[model samples]
Target: MKEILERRYTLTPFKKEIKGLKDAFRRASLRNLDSMRKRGFRPKNISYYEEVILGEKRYEELKGFSGRIIGYFCTFIPQELIYAARAIPIRLCSGFYDTVLVCEEILAKDICPLVKSSFGFKISASSYFELCDAVILPTPCDPKKKLIEILSDYLPVWVLKIPQDKTSSSKEIWLEEIKSLKERIEDFTKTKLTRQRLEETIKLIHKRQTLFRQLYEIRRANPYLMGGRDFLLVIQTSFYDDIERWIDKTEELCKQLSKEKTHFKTDEKIKILVTGSPIIWPNFKLLNIIEDLGAEIVCDDLCSGTQSLYNLVEPDEPTTDVMLGAIADGYLLSSVCPCFIENNDRIDRVLNLIEEFRVGGVIYHSLRLCQLYEIESHRLRLILKEKKIPMLTIHTDYSQEDTEQIKTRVEAFLEMLKR
Candidate 1:
């Protein structure tokens, strides 16, 4: 029944239209690229404003404005906090004015370079700290903790402690932390965040998230109606501070997908799910590499992928309460990345996706020296092996520069899966 569903999805005429829609997006991206450059922009990484028009200037330019600026150390911080504070909350992932130089001073050099690079970017410029009113660090991992320690020394850093244990008590800890986070935000911003504001933010976010999830569903509808590569661009374009534009893109993409139908070629027998921690940025090359090797990347469970697909917000609930609930839940909990946690349910979720998708294999991407994900890689391989699922694990920084070796391993893995 599942295979039949997959087959029908891939071959339908709708899939063809969907594929066309994906191609149209690429052309659109290119067409806009020159204009984007004129607007002082780049690709999905930095030109998000150009991509969606979130006001012409960079988000940090409002220096004279008395609005507080909240910085989240990762992607998981509740956006409602920023909305509630009447402040701009930016994820501390990238696009800083300076090179990172604080990692070595605060953290062990043995950790990943990404963390180091982020620190370098921040410390490279003095103005980096000037725009930040406070830092929200979710206790998701050691690197994040170290990042908080370093940033706190320079600015107001509030740490939201996440529970290491995967139990009912975890929810309790999260609720208390949410309250604490609320108080902290109010204290620092001198803005009274009422329940109504929080609730409003929740409704807005929920609407946005629902559209985001639907876009993924369209992307996931297979024969490859939508190019996963293009789909990733849609996802990464939302990471920055453009809430309105993000929502617009989501709606537009959904409308486009709904009107079209298409699927990717099924010439390659091998199909797999790419698994890893949160992909800090979108990398379309990973999808390209697999397809180039006569293999199909049917799905991914990365943070920037399926793991981001979340449930809907209740319409009857108060917006702030829903916002509070979202925080208490792990939806926006940046620190609870499955790679950094010891939860078996996450592992099980991966396996289930693999099974339901009828994936022939699993490709585990572990960032170099990303200790938690590396550990999970080994355990996952064992579990997959027991299930007779061929697996390949690769370690590298998330750079397109490493494509050659990654391609080789991916090709070899697909060959093994084929056999």
Candidate 2:
């Protein structure tokens, strides 16, 4: 075991070693997916989402896709522009623990696990990272900004500079950045982004957002119509699934959920509101622990979850510039990420979700070395305390070493909520 660990961490691992690691990661992903699928009664329509996350179905779909495959990092990158430019945008955020270990060879040990995991995929040529013709990255934090420098070595990387403040000047600056991104994408795809194309794409995504809102409302049922793990899977899959097909399937899932009977009684389990760093697929340790402890996560403020779908692009006019402005505003202004200097919006958003979901308690999940979410969690905890709401902050990474600890803490938190 000691020799194997040393070989794995060596400066130059053999190609066969990398392949073995990739296979291990895939098996781990499948196991997590299977466990999540079996946890609660899942609507049959949701199986499509599981398949997409598993990579096979999405790979088949993208194999036949007619446009350039554009990979993006953060939700702040406007997807409407990619669709308008006749390209497919895949969110490249990853949560596989094995990949994080692979990245430690290059990235500093103190870096956030999410960044390491994502960079690891590129290094290992795992998942869809190899399929991307170009990558778009938003600089929300220091690690991500550095990621742009590192990833540029592999493919064409377009950097979208995010503003720290949300002011009129900041909006103007961001709007210009969006315009620059449009020109870059258009140049890369050799497809002119016309007013009509942008308008059509905006309308199409608006429809998808509407379907997401319907699902969100359906989750508000006193006895959850869908399990939190299953719901997270649906949202996470949206990062890679074909938009039209995802919308259709999600619409069907919502209808199926509307007719299905609730499984647990309202009083049998406590409602939980999750907030903080994005919990990408396969690293669902926090969510699984919460649900396994007899609590249901009715809502969350994670960028990877509800925050990605909550806002809509409301263009005042059908013109391309107006629509682009709307997209920029929707991504920048509506974002509740803690990277922004003023986090009052995040506080208000969490408080609103707690009331809206009738949450009995809150779980603030922070990935190790992710200072943005960790610092914000402290202030948020103080506010929640004043409201007499229970908030538990769990600091963890992609590894499952802390699974038992998290479960123990969550179990205790659920007990407190019940009391």
Which residue pairs does candidate 2 place in steric collision?
none
Tens-place lDDT digits, model 1, residues 126-197: 223346777777766677766666655455668777677656677777777777778877877888889888
Off by over 4 Å in 1: 1-66, 94-108, 126-131, 262-270, 282-288, 291-296, 309-316, 319-323, 330-336, 339-341, 398-402
Question: Least lDDT summed over 10 consecutive residues: which range in candidate 1?
Answer: 10-19
Shift in Å, residue 311, candidate 1? 4.9
Candidate with maximal TM-score = 2
Candidate 2 minimal-lDDT segment of 10 residues: 1-10
User: Which tens-of-lDDT digit does each residue in 222-322 have in candidate 2?
Assistant: 43778888888999988998888888888888888887755545445688998889999888888877877678888898899988988999999998878
- Which runs of model 2 end up more than 4 angstroms from their true locations? 1-17, 38-40, 64-66, 261-267
